[model samples]
Target chain A: MTRVGDVLARCRAEGRAALIGYLPVGYPDVPGSIEAMTAMVEAGVDIVEVGVPYSDPLMDGPVIQYAVETALAGGTRVDDVFTATAAVRDAGAPALVMTYWNLVMRRGVETFASDLAAGGGSGLITPDLIPDEAGDWIASSESHGLDRVFLVAPSSTSERLTRATSACRGFVYAASTMGVTGTRTSVGSAAEGLVARTRAVTDVPVCVGLGVSNGEQAADVARFADGVIVGSALVRCLTEAPTRADGIRALTDLTRELAEGVRARRSTPGGAPGGASGMVASA
Target chain B: MTTPGRFGDFGGRYVPEALIPALEQLDEVRRKAMIDPEFVGELERLHRTYTGRPSILTEVPRFAEHAGGARVILKREDLNHTGSHKINNVLGQALLTKRMGKKRIIAETGAGQHGVAAATAAALLGLDCVVYMGKVDTERQALNVARMRLLGAEVVAVENGSQTLKDAVNEALRDWVANVDDTHYVLGTVTGPHPFPEMVRDFHRVIGIEARAQVLDLVGRLPDVVLACVGGGSNAMGIFHRFLDDTGVRLVGLEAGGAGVTTGRHAARFSAGERGVLHGAFTYVMQDVDGQTVESHSVSAGLDYPSVGPEHSYLLDIGRAEYRPITDVDAMEAFRLLCRTEGIIPAIESAHALAGAIDVGRELGPEAVLLVNLSGRGDKDVHTAAQWFGLLDDAALQSAGAIASADATGVSSLTDGVQV
Candidate 1:
């Protein structure tokens, strides 16, 4: 019943950053996916983003794209993404739906948000939709209990950055660079700078995505970010690990690993945590 | 038919395990399609009715005069619908996609020729299409974006690294990964995971098949040499594929040397680059130590690429064909020579082949007949050609721009050997 920001605030109060992991709804198989989502929650994921498969995902890197293909071929569709997320809702596990605008647009913004909320999705991340251009979807999403988030990259101008921050609802997505999501050992310091600039624009949570490829990188990113979203690495593990179960286990463990990483350094010299309760950005 | 994956180590499939099954399935698809009566009949129908098959083979006597009197024949693929031999492969692949039960198609294109052709095929097939072009190329070829849109393809301008043809390929592959269940990637050139190079070449071999028979019929004997320009080398493959078994035909593949072998701004895969994996299969690639593909530059945008088709590598090693270079200056001269001497303006990419033939023709003497594929009309190069010839700055060409039939792709479409 709590909002995505509420869970993030609870994590901040506990001196830990939210760790969001994304997994295709029917990856490996339906049962395996359910088990994976459950495993991710048990392993320490504060939030999960269940993807709705689309015929085209132009923004994804090779790893996540392949996961989408595998998942779709295994029969994962938009309804399944919500169906799979129902368990997360029933168990009180915090989750959101990560997908392309094409899939979201097809489902209709209001229907998508309400369906996501009904299935226990606490937030919505439309990586392709810039808020400045979002007229109807932004308004409808807020009315339906879904927090509409936007991604701003290092190349985003300060003007656009301000507009993006104002338009965002749940958390501001701070991309490390103009590139697609992929594995990297560490987040660039530019990411830290961008996070700070976004923080100045709004009190809403900012999730630094892209290049937060591993637990250590996530820990490093959480030093300045409210949350960290790991996409390609989790998808890569889901597809490449020796066994389907091992892959799921590895992905689920990433959330806990990243969570404990930032939690371990809460008392360090740097600003340890930012509060969860705040006015979500209102445009 | 017993050919192994290795092109004596030059054309082997060096992909990861995850891609092998897909590659093999594609190769099988190719094998079955070749022998399937219905498939063959459908292809023939498209070739004859749709693409205007058996495209003309012309004899260039004036250009041939410089050649020790060696007879020269030009296979006029420029005369094909939508222009360029790129149409042949894209149509074949689009047809195959429909056969495979896929409803959506995706492709990567540079210089707009392949993109236009792919979009045209998608439109005709009534399939949804997405074209990923590099942002740089999209800017340079804005006309192509409009053309693709007219064909009902959503043109996505990829703002990724370098924003050239290679980046477009990477983007298309990523799209394929995400939508593999319902989408078929119509790879433009003879690159990417196996079967594509082989498949595209097979689709285009009709050029060589037509040229060979025409040469033997008209000249009463096989020509001493055959020449075509090489970028991804589909044009070269189109004219050379059938000649692979012909030992008497001297096969010459001309690559862009840019300025010279040492100048480094050229698309000479065999002459300058090493074998590497690009798109999908292993081929001659222009790359640095870290295995990153290097940027290749040439006066011809179509030839401005870093790799050659894997099949070309196989042909090179098996001693069936030879790849050499034609500098930018030399290609332009050949472009002018064909225009002035024969009154036919040829695509700058095909002009590389003309430059190569001019070099070897003089040595071969008057009796030799060399088949050069006039792959496309040179209208697309009018602006660049004007700059190269200093037409805008030079008073002579500027005055004759309208009289020369070398204005842009449109004017060239009205000239000799042009099928407008």
Candidate 2:
């Protein structure tokens, strides 16, 4: 299985932003979620984030929370999440585990990291954990040779941006808006500025999420970001579908459109490696 | 004070990225305010003048007879402005909102005491306030909803995810995330992320401070047992903080055992809960094997939370305090005991502590002195209590001197002069 770093680097080499897709594990059920993720990978999603279902998802809006509640009701345990990650990895996407920090802490951080690595997961995205509180996780991820991804928001100060990007290994997740995860009619204007500000601190690839639902918004974010992440939109497609097959088809169709939109913005101005490196040098 | 963001392995900032800067700002401002005399002076003045501070300590000889003839002292926080200890934390946070220049305060309520207190503080401070309450709780405690509205606050009924306090908290958090710049989330209890448990505890510490001094004046010694109900543990921590260093004073927290622990329906965290994360605190939460939070059942809506405060978790861990569960039957029996013996109608939440005090007093013998925190008045629980005692029937209501429309002519005359 490919690492998330290699996927992003490959996307950069091709002069386009990576299309990262997110879905909770065991959403419809264990096998159903895996098949849906496989469909997303085949339809051109470069990186996949398999969320571990939690009861209280403070960061999630309605759509993903509903899906996760259903997944939990269907008995999606941590072991099932590992199984789902392995299946997604085998399906040809670098599967990253995105989850609340408690799920990892409850299972012992080292054990969780090792098990995810054994399941062929590339990295982790901790939505609620900040860089300052990630000491044990940093050590565990390093020991397990797994990526550590941290999030930055528009409200983050320069010091926080530097700390977050420095802590991140795979990519930095930039929340496109100052709210919970859901689709929005328009992405926050601060997202582009935030990406530029984050670039000034580190050369790590920056991905923007939280409001990218359709192809146009994906293309708009793709112009400035190293990766474009779509989560609630994909979950909405699956949740609003009448059947499992319809859900997979909807997810695949959306993934294909988003991939095309991200690829449409070929060779963004000053998007080359040197442009990112120049910002790092200036910093 | 021990550390900013942790209570042993229990508490930290486990919120979304969007609220990071806001939380940092709140922590910074709160730290500065703690040392500033003007802020301290303002809170003190509000307590003395507006909140009727230094709430009296009353000893009930008759009530003591029920507790195996042990001397019982009650710290009367129920006499506060909003009829609960919730007012203390609300006033402190409301002042903090002014210091931070936030114009709006949003809060979540379970039994509506916190909502009323928040609304009262907001009105006193002249800030816009909005409260989210569970739909079921709104029906149960409709008077509190009306009280919040009368105090010039907006009450939003939350209908999702069990339609209870947890769901109300989620909705309030969503509002704060969406509007963090102009809004301050007035979390009701000693829970949530960093600074909240610590900050709320600091605000309510006066309960212990005054009670300690008052008890020393009255009894010339500390209490043998200090007890309070532990729903999110604000009141327990408030009265327990000063007594913690007094090694002889046994601090006991009474959790609401709705039925029994054997029935899988109770809010007894130490007795039945496991260590897991919920509502931003890594505390003793009732959860399944898969880490999914199990809903807690308590006759007292205020005590129906699954997760407890992190500070309580730390105290329970370090052997500084002990927590026990009180069943609904025993609590209500204690509730009636206080009303009949001491002429004090204690909230059902507070009756749990009273019930624990009875058991502890019996165990410690007749010479022991027990200090129990009367956290709130039972005026808000009249309907629940009426139903519990089968006092809702016409005969029972009339026997209780509830009017039963005997003065219909006079009532009609008064309504005739008023607009419909």
Candidate 3:
């Protein structure tokens, strides 16, 4: 099994934060998407989370909602998402998927998990599917050799902490705020608290998403968690640049910027020495 | 009795921590502004001049003649601007949004009429509008898309699960969560957490308030029955409000039976849905026993939701009004019958009430005066109706749409007033 500690060690040794970018399943056209993913890999991407658009994306803001609509209108299906990931796999990049439980539930978790595993997907991140209500999914996904990435918010209870750790395989996603996914100018103090609380529950790696915007925010967040997941900022990357190449270039540039920021702090002698950088240096 | 504004044990504000301060702020300012002389005056002026309120009290005698000779009167909201009672609520909510000094409006729409109305109001007030609709509904109601864009609104099609009204409500709730500080969420129907149903009903109450007086003036008596369609129940609630306390006015609420309520194919929440909290408060919800919401359907896209407002639930429980269902076939039949009899095309959603009135009239017989609310005109249903009845090829439906107008006798006919 690919353990959380190992992924964390490898990420630290590389001196890079995991760059997770989400693209709508059939957005900018599906075949065009394969080319884009390959481009993103060549541009130095770490991980990718493909969003399967649903008709009721209860958590998305307008920007992502528009993107999902555009993609679904193009007839993006779960199979299409799997097919779309072929480019990521052929390009040899690890990929995760972010979608609502309803889609997976409707498709039957066992079938979806197997299909996703067969399609070369790595992990799953569902913000609303609670660990308590997700037993069937956890068993099915784990049975199919998939990582069930559970989310823990700042408002999560101790019971939630226990449930989240036991149900998850990959790093537990720690939401930094009380609300839905959105942008904020700075990292909250509660971010550190949530990490500390989750650290007490189990030995699994913890990652934060939903508020980090730039290299500085990622750099700030990298100080505490295993890795940082950036979405809206990356989606913004797609809209900012005129072409897919420019979009890939933007993500690659930010990935490198954040990687360097994490590396500097990791390499400093005895400054904070628990990560892979210290192990490599000591060896 | 029962504090006037409540709906069953389920209609109070059960909001999150973040929404409290803003809601309380709205409460303090809303009551004062709604009751102010200037505000009321402007609202009335717009209601009269722009919307053509004091909307007509119509009599359907041929239909009435069939109904054991009962006198059937219609409250003609279908003649209002934009062709539905949705205009009545949107205008009021829009004015309140403006007075709050907000610059942007966000709403969730299903069939797109409410989105059109909200967009129209935002355009009139020069406010930026963002209407989130389920992607499926967007495809289904494309003409409404053109209408909204012409009004200068941004239409964000949501591709969430089921791609229906409930999902649109969820997306709109998510938007309100992120932008509660600077934006106003103009909820179309009256089913969200709190104050939405109450606030929307207050705006629509003008319909019932006006009709009560008009019916008395015209007929010299109160109606034996007052009826309207119930989707989110805003129109029904609005039309039912003044009659809530009237002992003699028998208010009836009609819900869409879709294929049939028993077959689980309808959007008649009050008939099949149970009491549960959805959106923000407890109300009649189309949820499974496990509590997840189920998808609802109706021939009328506007009424196609799995839940209804809390206040309507309260009304049903307290027996203040009666809730019944009208199937798609029934509503369509009423749609064709009304057009041939009265020269008016009603919205499919509103046609549900027209269906109820037809039944109620037959049962009541001669000497019974019933008021059926024509909640909206039916231009949108022309395409759907044409397809259903083979009018697409029959060449009978698309005849310049010039049906014989029912004269002052409350009945007109091309074929001796015998539709059957």
Candidate 4:
């Protein structure tokens, strides 16, 4: 199992869903992003997903697009993604790099895998690289002892869902909505059904993302998922902040609130949250 | 996931999972429609009655004078109903949209040719149409934007990521993902993920089919070479697919060289691009060393994309076809030559092909017969052409005004010292 898998297992052992927070490296600047990620870990995020700001983020909404544009304008390089990953790992949370496939392909898949492993990164969460086109990444990550996290959506066929879940090493990402990443007033109604469908296919932990923002939404997703993944909400803290320090504080406070929401689900009896059942299935 | 759409290792669906089912449905419907006689007959009827197909092949001896005395034949795609080859694909995809029971169609366009075609098709079929155009492009091709709006389509100006065709495509994909259930993404070119490159190519294959038969009937033999501009490569691929089996015919694609390839301000993908994924297909993409897509520049908004279609990449790799860069200066010079010599105004995108023909004509010398795809008319490019030739400047306008007054008043002094 990968370090990310172990972290998810540990969170399940604690009878709570894992809180995964994402922030693009070099949002304000590289050093500032690393500090923010470190603060997230200290504030109760179980895993840190360091986003590599791409030039064309097709699956991103305006807030994340704005953050990525700022990050790219600030000169975020591929090397900085690893640096931020190391910072997150140093802060005691498992770190995963969520990136588009081209950057890794540009760096050479094996070379990128080795670099991420060297930086103590647990795995990758590829938003665009589905299992069908991930042969090279799957092999490279396995050789480097890193996880491969592919996503499943409501539109995914059962065959594709099984293939994607079976390919996943650490966990499977379930996008809660059909649209790109952004905070919605409420998560899509299809998310629970998609998560349940994914769980039926593989023993890999299923994490839900794509719209969860606040504690209520996080707790709502945590009720059915093994992990609650938040991205735009956390990145918006940095994007809308007056100062880097304030951004870090906002990130920390939000992380704690989301973390609390993930834990709060365990108090309800007969909740049948995926964390406890996923641990059993994997075991 | 399937390999049916691949051209060697180039084309595949590298898109979000939410789009996969839609692509699969589109592929299935397209495959069936291609084999269905009723569908094929309906499309043929549309082409003959609506698009004015068998778009005549014209011989231009005057223009050929500049091309080293070579015999030049023009495939008159400019005469198509929507004024370009884009109508073929949009009409076919609109039929497929109706087949899928989809109510609305969304499209992305750069030069606005495809958007206008898509809007036209949607209006003809009684479907809602929305076109995503880059903010920069909406201004550069403002005439086409107005045309689209007049065709009863809503035009959205995409504002992010260089604000060009690439960004417009990104915005269109985002819209498709959110609204895939009831809306069909009428992708503008021979790019994008699975089925699009293949389906769009199939729809446009008539260009090559008709040209090949016409050249045989007129010239009594195949031309020595065929040339077309490579933007997303639809027109080039359209006219080249039929001649692929003819080993003697040389197929060359002219890419936009805005300033020059070395200036880092051109859209010559095969000239200076690396193999990477962009807009869902693996192809020659102009990207930084870190794999970040670099902005492509071109005087012609149609060819201002940073990536080429995957099949073009495959063709280049196998040496079945050749691609070369044509600088803006060369293209404009050819654009003017076509206008002055042949009295034909070609789209700036097609002017790139005219520029390449000039060079190739010289290389092959007088006996060579060159078939050039006049992909679109330059009515939409009059503004850009006027600016390029300084015809829109105050001095030139004033000179023309003076000449007009001289004609009206029979006054020699009004015409004196006037450039006109």
Highest-scoring model, lDDT:
4
TM-score of chain A of 4: 0.96
Write the residue-wise lDDT of candidate 2 on B205-313 in tens digits.
Answer: 9999999999999999888999999999999999999888999889999998989988989989899998877777778888877667788888898998888999999
DockQ of each: 0.03, 0.41, 0.11, 0.61
The prediction achieving the highest TM-score against the true structure is: 4
Model 2, A135-157: lDDT tens digits are: 88999999888998899999889
- Show where candidate 3 strays beyond 4 Å: A1-57, A60-179, A182-209, A212-283, B1-6, B13-18, B394-420
- Model 1: residues with Cα > 4 Å off, grouped in runs: A1-257, A261-283, B1-4, B14-22, B393-420
Model 1 per-residue lDDT tens digits across residues B1-420: 122454555444432222333455567777888899998898889889988887998888987776556777899998888888888898888878877888999988877788888988998889898888877666555556666766677888775555678778778876664456678888887766566777888888899899889988998988788999988888888888788788988899999899887888778888878766565556788865424456787887778778888878888887888989999999999999889889888989999999988988888777677889999887766656777887676665444333333222222223331221
lDDT of 3 by residue, B10-62 (tens): 56543333344455556656678688998889889888888888799878876
Residue-level lDDT for B161 in candidate 1: 55
Candidate 4 chain B weakest ten by summed lDDT = B406-415
Q: Which stretches of candidate 4 lie above 4 Å from their native place?
A: A266-272, A275-277, A281-283, B395-420
Q: Estimate how well candidate 1 is docked, as a DockQ score.
A: 0.03
Better of 3 and 4 by TM-score: 4
Q: What share of the true interface contacts does each candidate keep?
A: 0.03, 0.45, 0.17, 0.72
Better of 1 and 2 by TM-score: 2
lDDT of each: 0.74, 0.87, 0.72, 0.90
Residue range A22-65, candidate 1, lDDT tens digits: 77777776767777878877787778777665434545676776
Better of 1 and 3 by DockQ: 3
lDDT of 1 at A46: 75
TM-score quality measure for candidate 1 = 0.60
